[model samples]
Target: MEDKKRVGIWIRVSTDMQVKDDSPEHHERRARYYVESRDWQVEEVYRLEAVSGKTVMNHPEAQRMLQDLRSGRITGLVFSKLARLARSTKELLEFAEIFRREGADLVSLAEQIDTSTPAGRLFFTIVAAMAEWEREEISSRVAASVPIRAKMGKPLGGQASFGYKWHDKNIVIDEKEAPVRKLMYEIFLDCQRKKTTAERLNDLGHRTRNGSRFSDTTVDRLLRDTTAKGQRLANHTKSVGEGKQWITKPQQEWVIVPCAAIISVELWEKCNAILEEQLSKRARKGRISEYLLAGYVKCTCGTSMYVFSTAKKFTCKNCKNNVKVADMDEIYQQVLKGYLNDIEPKMYVEELEKAIAEKEYLLTTSTKKRAQLRKKMDDLVPLRVSGDLDKEHFAAIYQPIVAQVHQLDKSIPELQAQIDFERIQLNSTDHVLKEAKGLYESWTKMLFPEKRAIIETITEYITVGQDTIDVGILHLSPSSKLTSQHQFMGSWKLPT
Candidate 1:
């Protein structure tokens, strides 16, 4: 009796493929059939489900299979398709060399490439090159489509902006969200400060698209988006490999689609002018301190605090509050322990899951409502075209619907953002706790900048008072470092 050949099967499916029900089982069945047809025994199966073929770094099962192959445990490796093995040509060639060196045969059933023959090996390389070229071609085509869509005032793809909704392949304003955006502009223009504006918005129960409390950065970005002004600007950036690089396209090249402007052009310009002035003022301050707690520390006397020249003390410019840097560090460590201790990781995870589910539900309901509005607006289009509805009446009716759809567009993204944030927090809860402990223990070895960064990451700020030190804990997923650092004073006191 011939010895049954030991073979390993590798199965993987991308996210898109998985959603379509093209599961790993289908790949497994094919591999089993191929191996059994040759009277080979299945040594093991390595399955990667809903995982992208973009990189092997995240696939631990694939790594284990390779390790077994390298150890000469398997005589053959089999997969249903070449692309399933890897999307990159470079990785494919590397895998071929490994199989060749390990004395293992490579089999791709779809392409009918068996690496036991020199002709088959050559054909595998050609197929890998073709697969890679096809992937790049697809990426290029998708990237090129963005500007074209933007020019036509269609949905720019991805998440719809705040106060906008997707309808019949176009982006229209959401009525519910448009009021919120308009309020944001009004509040921002009135306050002329991102931090204060954020605080006021949050006070009014206004959460960002992600369902988190507003931050200065979020407020600033929302104010800066030209889309709120009813204009779609395109070609502001170009693809850079796996990322994008910003390139200021000429004004002439910018595709402007008239949107439902939430704020007037005049209001937008006025707000931006104030922002530019703030930027100029900040630029003039110059980067001077390398103190670990320079910008993060504040004085209870309502003044900015900085690292005193010796780096041993933090001095508040307005209140003459001074505290030893070491005192601040010790207090921070103690506060961190209490803060982390209060958080039950398991409960936190459950809470995050619940929050995510709630947001997802809200998005679904809002999307349905937006769809209804879209239908009404689409129905109006025919009336306008058939002269049954005059342009003014059509505008009066359709404008409100368009505004409502756009509002959902803003709301959906906010809910999605919150869901994404919570999911991330769930994943990192344990790591964050471990790192907090490590940061405290490894403080002595860290440089000033490293120490400052770690403190900034964990705590919102340290405030020095005449007899007390307040260290406010930045929430787990902090949006921005508190601008008015002494706004919330923690109960921690300085060592006498």
Candidate 2:
């Protein structure tokens, strides 16, 4: 039998009048009825009552809904209308992107849009494309003006570099900060280490403009800026996305605005030369992993084993235990084949689903109990206000209820977290099962890197004993996975 689609109902009412006319409960009921018509289960309800729709992506309820969706606790979201989901076009596009990436669905009743349907998917594509076009249009207009402003030596919409400030529409050195900036170059030249320079500056009680302790990255960025040498470069970089890293633009597009020099050009060149040499030396020593389980293998003595240079055996530094690389590889391949063939994903997922359902039920009953307790507490307040109860009586009644509510508050979240964790396991097992058959078929033909990638994906660790090899297998979703750092028992064992 096919599993019923699990979905969350979204309810956001911004105003008291809207609550009176439309109501969060009314919206939730409408969404629930729609879900029921399709035989989908309403797993959760995110209520954002009296919250602004203008920017709800950061709201606690919205975050919880997203978390549930991402963790696979729910696979879809149902709202009364698109506006209830989000009024902002950008946020609407973001929601669609997230749903699409997670292989989930979005259903809006009033708009008659369901991303599970072809027509609804088409509607989302069109809306997202239009939003992207609008954003690009605005971005291009801004980009066109940046070079002109840079060439004219005008402020380009951000604060000047740390040692300099924008004064009267001109870039000038900040007196107090310039000395510290110059000292950074001096320290780097003496020590030839960016980390050392940062530590020395921090020890001298110098901090960044934001008042944070200087770090190696901060020191490196300050050292690399050409503004210290008087030629301030602008329009040299472009951001790939919101909150993402910026990459260097084409050199021909760069604009250099002349500014006051902090240090001599000779000193700047010498410092950068040393940095380039150090980077080159590090790059020369870098090498790719030659063995399939280079990092995953560990000695049973609780130490990592590695194949030393010109050695064919993975040797443990602590216990002197060793295993031939080829033998270990052979054992791993046999283990991999058995592990992939042995996975009973359906049975495993059923167990996880049963656990999740139990936790969800517990969370629901606890929430209801808390609400009832809260109502009782509210009623007691009115009794005291009306002088129907004495202060001692009110206290006697309120304290226990408050204690029960607090306990429930803590327990309910714990239940929900357990549900979220099991749902992640359920999703990960599904993903690995779907991929395992193909991976096994292709394993013989895959190159070292390809095979290594799969090992990193499914393997928790490999422990090498004197006469036995044990492998721990854990298939985790890229978005949510327990770290292998936590100890896990081996799932496969072989006699050496």
Best by lDDT: 2
lDDT of prediction 1: 0.70
- Give candidate 1's TM-score: 0.34
For each candidate, what TM-score against the reference? 0.34, 0.51
Q: Write the per-residue lDDT of candidate 2 for residues 410-468, one digit (tens) a residue.
A: 56544544454445445545655666767777888999888888788678888977666
lDDT of model 1 at position 142: 84
lDDT of 1 by residue, 1-496 (tens): 8788799998876775653124465467656765655567999988787777777644788788888887877888888777988887667766765676566788776565655433355555664566557668887888777777777767655766788877887888887777888888899889898999889989998786679998899889888889998876666644442124355766765787777788899999999999999998788656666555667778777687767577577776665667777666666666665665555556655766787688778868886887788789879999999999998988999898888877776555445444543443444454454455455557678777776666765666566767666777765532322222222244544433
The TM-score, computed over Cα atoms with residue i paired to residue i, of candidate 2 is 0.51
- Alpha carbon lDDT of residue 125, candidate 1? 60
Cα error, candidate 2, residue 224 (Å): 3.8
Give the poorly placed runs of model 2, Cα more than 4 Å off: 1-49, 57-145, 162-223, 240-243, 259-288, 298-304, 316-322, 343-428, 444-450, 460-468, 475-496
